[model samples]
Target: MSEDFKKRITVAQADYTKSFIQNVFLQRTIFFLVFLILWQILSSLGIYPKFLLPSPIEVLETMFFGFIESDYLFAILESFRRVLLGYILAVFVGIFCGLAIARYKILDNTIGASLTALQSIPSVAWVPLALLWFGISEAAVLFIVVLEAFIPSALGVRTGVHTIPKEIIRAAQALGARSIDLYIRVIFPSIIPQLISSLRLSWAFAWRALIAGELFVNGVGIGQKLELGRSLADMSQVMSMIIIIAILGYVTDDLFFRTIEKKVQKIWGFNK
Candidate 1:
């Protein structure tokens, strides 16, 4: 390619990346606007009873007033605490277990397959066992969240390790790198992308698991609020809880995970 043409191409690519980020922000705003309009219209049209399918206004009121009266803040905080505790535990265990399986064929063959199979089982499926083992306590909820979050994290790490270039490992070994040094300096650093991906996936898993546990245990959370709304036939509260959850999930994923992914992709020269 001509130097002038290459220079133009580089400038175009930079412009495109900036435009893409702007577009994503615009799209998110547009999406929320569209949803709000549709919700308002549908509720006004009385597709369902107002109480059964509350309007956005009613839902917002429930979120601001009804939830406060119900001590929703404490519930949300408790749920967040449980989810974070379980997620952190899952990350630590998954990393250690993944490294072990990646380093040893025997461990991989004996345990990796079982772990893979277990992933197919929905986290909610373990609720009964968790309740039986730990009773309807925070431990049961943590157990369920851990079960959900651990599998994807472990798989992500294992796959990341497996995808590491053999040449890099060999070169590190030649440089007198022991197992710890090899992983720390070569293998682990090489999989930052996958680790971030795992963190995102783990958050989703744990969130779902937390809701499941709340449903079963009927504890303090948005999930418990959902159950309470259902019992009282209060659709506005239900909708409000759902909206808050969607907002929270989107904000976390976009602000943290997607942001990281973009930077990493750019650094890896894969963001074009």
Candidate 2:
């Protein structure tokens, strides 16, 4: 093909790709708006009692005014604080356990099997034990969050370690890399993509655990607000809290974890 024709084809393909992406985004936006309109119409028609199912506008209003008039802002900050602290601790513990389990076959067979089983149990299942041990304190909440998050993180690291090419390890060893050097320079870097995925999973687990813990334990948190709304039969407040939680989860995953994953994948040549 002539250079001019080739260039034209390339430009056409680019335009088509861009248009397709825009169309998809537009469709999604339209679908969401339509859903909200339908919800509003149903609420207005009184198909469901307002107490049971508040309109989107009501929920939005509650969410907006909540930060100003109520303790919603403090609740959000409190939840974030707990989750962040728990997630940070979980990452460190998980990585350490993962490295240990990966390095030792005996520990892998024993602890790894146990972790697999433990992971199947719901995070809330541990809440009772946490309550018994820590007695409705922040420690109880942190304990649940750490346990929920660390298992996935540890498992992810183990899988990542196992996936690493033996040749790379051998090369590092031959180059006088040992112990901490091997981990810092070779193992850790090699498993970054998997680590990012693990961290994302851990964050999700931690968030859920934090909420569950807060629901049971006495605290000023989003979960507490949700419980209070339920107690008061305030559907608007409940919906607002639910929406806020969903938004926070989506925002964190999209803005932080996914962004980091993409960049890491690109660096590792896993993305084109």
Candidate 3:
């Protein structure tokens, strides 16, 4: 193919990709708007009770005025604070456990397998134990969040280390790199991408766990509001909380994980 033809093909491909992305965003916006319109129309028809199917407008209105009068903002902040604490704890514990399993054969044979098995258990399964051990308090919620976040993190680090070429380690050792220096100069950097990927997974797990954990907490929280809404058969309040949870999850994912992922991709030459 001619050089000019090749250049034209590349430019055309890029333009098409950009246009496709724009169209996708537009399509999603249209879909959401149409869905809301249909929901409003059906709910306003009065065939079904409002409690069973609230109009989108009612849900939005409740979310606005209801939250201002209630402690909705406080609930959101409390959940966020708990998640942050659990995330930090998970990162530290996961790193240590992962390194121990990866570096030592005996620990890998026992604890590593156990952790892998534990990962299969749902985060909610731990709730009973957490509540029994700590009661319906912050500790139970924190424990559940840590349990959810740490497993993926440990596994991710182990995979990253194991997947590294043996020759790279040998070459680094030959250069007199040993112990902490070897990790700092060679191994640690190589595992950063995997570590960051796990952190994203950890955040997702933590977020889900937080909501579930909050259900057990007796105090103020979004999860508590969810339960209250259910008891009162307040569908608008329930939907509003669900929407808030989704928005918060999306915002955090974008703010922390996606930002890190983009930067890492750029540095790793995966992006132009």
Q: Point to the candidate with the largest TM-score.
A: 2
The digit string of per-residue lDDT tens for model 1 on 56-99 reads 88888888996568687887888888899999999998888888
Clashing pairs for predicted structure model 2, backbone only: none
Q: Which segments of candidate 3 are over 4 A away from where they belong?
A: 1-22
lDDT of 3 at 255: 80
What's the TM-score of each model vs. the native? Answer: 0.86, 0.91, 0.88
- Tens digits of lDDT, candidate 3, 1-272: 99999999999999998897789768789989999999999999998998999999999999998778978898888878889999999988998888889999899999999988988888889989999999989999999999989988998888889987899899999999999999889988878888888889888998888889988778888888898899899999899999999998888787878899889978966664
Please identify which of the two predictions, 2 or 3, would achieve the higher lDDT against the true structure.
2
lDDT score, residue 47, model 2? Answer: 82
Off by over 4 Å in 2: 1-22
Scored by Cα lDDT, where does model 2 land?
0.94
Residue-wise lDDT of candidate 2 within 106-186, one digit each (tens)?
Answer: 999999889999899898999999999999899999999999999989999999999999999999999999989999999
**Minimal lDDT window, size 10, model 1:** 66-75
